[model samples]
Target chain A: MEEVRNQQVILKDYVNGLPKESDMLLKTSSTILLKLPKGSNGVLVKNLYLSCDPYLCCLMSKSQVSHLESFTPGSPIAGLGVAKVVDSGHSNFKKGDLVWGWTGWEEYTIITAPDALFKIQHTDVPLSYYIGILGVHGMTAYYGFHEICAPKKGEYVFVSAASGAVGQLVGQFAKLTGCYVVGTAGTNKKVELLKNKFGFDEAFNYKDEQDIDEALKRYFPEGIDIYFENVGGKMLDAVLLNMKTNGRISVCGMISQYNLNEEEGVRNLSHIIMKRLHMKGFIVGDHFNLYPKYMEMVIPLIKEEKICYIEDIGEGLESAPAALLGLFSGKNVGKQVVVVAHE
Target chain B: MEEVRNQQVILKDYVNGLPKESDMLLKTSSTILLKLPKGSNGVLVKNLYLSCDPYLCCLMSKSQVSHLESFTPGSPIAGLGVAKVVDSGHSNFKKGDLVWGWTGWEEYTIITAPDALFKIQHTDVPLSYYIGILGVHGMTAYYGFHEICAPKKGEYVFVSAASGAVGQLVGQFAKLTGCYVVGTAGTNKKVELLKNKFGFDEAFNYKDEQDIDEALKRYFPEGIDIYFENVGGKMLDAVLLNMKTNGRISVCGMISQYNLNEEEGVRNLSHIIMKRLHMKGFIVGDHFNLYPKYMEMVIPLIKEEKICYIEDIGEGLESAPAALLGLFSGKNVGKQVVVVAHE
Candidate 1:
């Protein structure tokens, strides 16, 4: 039996507040057996691309673990990734098959539950696309905007964390539905990308604005009809005040509140009553059934270059920590992806 | 034509914070003609029972008014009430018809839109029931609990302000659905009424509990599946933490926050994301279309004595201000009704 070095990113300890790069350690000692052991049912795969998502921060804390499991200190941190099967004892996948789903943050991983992975069919698009635009973020944006928000033509829509993976797509989806779309990003550059590249009606850097409610009021003078709540806390408070009668808020991720010991209080929830708003929180895993329907709509747009995707890529496994950490500070311009291998 | 002196409750000014009895002045200056004016399209109604509701506090504030109109200074305060049509110029209403809908807080009122009034057909039940269990509170509790919450059999249900007008009915409705029902009130007396009269599985005085979250966890060991949100603020904050996966919250009113200049901020809103909670705010006026369906179900319940109703009646128009003001202090137990006339 032959073994090979597998560089891995391990959670150093349970994170207390905002996750720092030092909270994760890059180790090279971990190795993967070249061949599967006797009676093994797992598939051995080499990770190609790994996603750096905001919700990963929630899983870092030991206290919050209902939706996702907490990252153990000594083990490789796991996340949604693109991988190529190097060896397999599973019937569904064979050697050289491409897949995406729950995989370890390592150069190579042994996927015990091979059925959990999604087999890649389209080789025309970049394989890294599996980590973002075609992955969990893609499904979330589709289901949340279309099913939850129930966007109608000419309605006013707002998206927070508007330049990030899911936010960018939600804004585009709103625009495609003939809705007036506005987005909020942390940086001026990301804001520019939202308006110019994503074709949003208006975009603003929330960090530059002194008052979020004033910023929302300026963008949505008639008041927002639908709000895609990606960053909760104060943003949700401001959006609640600016929401129109019969408004909808799809609570996807509250990245701003994820790292806090006690999440910030939202003061304007009474507006939920006054405005007759429907605010619902949903997870991507719950809506996997919509993936086929999502692909039928989004694939043609991607093929025709009608929809645009912006990605901020990190080069290697060592860069995963910084890429993930950058999410909190809004350092990444678009979808944050870590490329572990070129293939 | 004979003209009679009409006693009225007039708003002194827009209430700043919590409303006081002095904010509404009992004036007897107005007079109404016994007969309708020629070429008129209105109904002259003698006010019978005026409902003292917590949402009136929202109307007291100058800032909030989207669906309902705000009361102007020196003008009569308007609300849901039971009235008798003394004279009718409208085709739908005749003389001596009992009706309920929007009416002024006066001894006699000339209702311009007689079409807005719902004619009381069943005289078997108490006439005051038209202002409460058969009126706005009834429809609100019915629509909010059944239509919005989508309660399932054996589901754990929690109602805030459980002994109040709408809450009491919602608790009973949950019990009828074969749900595990628990409720909270400000006083132990109301709590006892919730458990004994309303048939809630358990009840607690929220004021007694040092930690509301703990109190909820004690009663709902499994977790609350449906929450009828009447009083928002810290209680809502606590409920958010105790809500189960895919919990539903029908937000009817936030009485606690209505009086405050700066409303209390809810801290555990993030639980909505973790638990995949669905929260919707609604007005009974929006669900008026469901009233016929509501009456079809509730009239039988009332006739069979399957549901119990409790009212704290205030005699005469002079006690109107005290009754309305008492809602903020939890003074009047059950449905607070101010009787202007017996017949």
Candidate 2:
């Protein structure tokens, strides 16, 4: 086995506020053997599609208290990536197997915990879909909406950051469930994408609205039954006021508050009691067991044109840093992915 | 039957911020007919015990959005009360039948909504107990703890306002479920009552602790699994930080915030997502169907002396204003009830 140059994206240092592109460095000095060592219980993989997730920004932070393992300043930043197994010692994954799991931001990686790697059963669809639409992001939207929010038919649903990787899917899922769905995004383009392309009943650019509460009251006159909360802070405060009795809030992410030095205080939390609301928070990794069921339900829809997924792909590993940081700035139009090596 | 003077507690005006005793005027001008008019559907009752609940303060405000009807100035204040049927046109009640329901804070009155009146089968317990231990306060504690919190054996349970009407019962119920319970109160006496009388595993005086989060850390090193949220300002914020993964919070009341001109902003609600917490707000009034089942479960425990309820009785209707306002100041030692008349 020969050592190959592994071009990687590395965290320059732990980020403070909104992550700058310089916070991540692209390095080519890293090299890895394209073979698993003898008797080593690992799978050596050539990374293909690397997912640019908002949660990766949380990992770039200095906070050690978070459930996600923080990225070391000098280490290669890691995230969910689709890969082709080059060599393997693990029984589940063999050589030439298409898999996706916790892989690095480099061309090649030897996954020490092969348990994290899942074999791709159907390659009938695009393999890169495993990184976004068919991966943790997809599963997150599925479990977070169907399980956490528990949307009923004809219910009023609201999604924040509506055109992002997860939010776009949540809005569509709400529509598929026969719910009256409304979404909020930073830019008019994303808002337009939400209403026009994603089949949302209504969409609003929150930046245009002077008062978020008044905007929500205007859009949701009857009040919101379910809130898919991706961007928390003032938006969450507004949603709390607008929620109807027995409303459910699925706390998928708080991207708006994550970069702030001090998280904004939510003033209308007592409305949860008055309205008899249920607010739950969940992690997709914890609900991975639902993956097979998720695919079974989602694939038929995708194949039949009953559902759609939009991907915004960066060409190479060099673009990974900017693409990943772009999430906080609302730069990516749809599901953000960086294409590394083509199979 | 003849017209009689009804000594009543009337709202001088809608209260602002912390209610002063002067906000409620003791009026003797009110008069009512003791006889039920022919073809009338109402029931006339002699008020025995009037409940001074924390929720009444919310009614004193001018917020029409609240589920509770605001107290109209110059009109008699109304709340949950134990009464004796003097004259009845409603079939559910007859002369001398003891009943309890929504009644005016007065000597005698006509209950327009006779359906709201519940017949008291068990005079075996103290009649005043109907206004405290066996009424909405009891049911709030029961449903809030057993249904919402869904306590599993050996789970860590924390209750704020631990010696108050609802919180004390929640702590006791947690103990019955084999949970390790900790409670927080405003005073050392109340704390002692929680630990010793209520059989909580531990108790703390929140007033004594400068840092509530650190105090909770001291009490629950492994972190809280169930938090019965009664006072929902700073205590709720602190509890959010201390909650374990998949923690459940039953938001029964936010006494601390009800009187504030601008309710305190909860800063750590985002922790709900990071910790995968489930926070639900509920009203016992919505769960009235569970009352009979609750009575069956709780009556036996009360009869066997397995559970205890403490009542802080104000002498008469004149003390009602002070007793109700005392809840916010943490002046009432236990369940605050005003005894208006004797059997």
Q: Which has the greatest DockQ?
A: 2
Model 2, A262-300: lDDT tens digits are: 778888888988899999998888998899899999999
Whole-model Cα lDDT per candidate?
0.91, 0.89
TM-score of predicted chain B, candidate 1: 0.98
Among the candidates, what TM-score does chain A have in each?
Answer: 0.98, 0.97
Docking class of 2: medium
lDDT of 1 by residue, B1-343 (tens): 8899999999999988888888889998888888888878999999999999877766877877447777888889989899999999999999999999999999999999899899999999999998999988999999999999989999999999899999999999999999999999999899888888889999999999999999998999899999999889999999998999999999998888887878898989888888999999987788798898999999999999999999999999999888888888899889999999999
In Å, residue B26's CA in model 2 sits off its true spot by 0.4
**Please, what are the lDDT tens digits per residue for candidate 2 over residues B51-129?**
8888888888887346788989988889999999999888888999999889999999888889988899998999987
Looking at candidate 1 chain A, the ten consecutive residues that score lowest on lDDT are A57-66
- What's the CA error at residue B142 for candidate 2, in Å? 0.9
Instruction: Say which docking band candidate 1 falls in.
Output: medium
TM-score of each: 0.99, 0.98
| Candidate 2 to truth, TM | 0.98
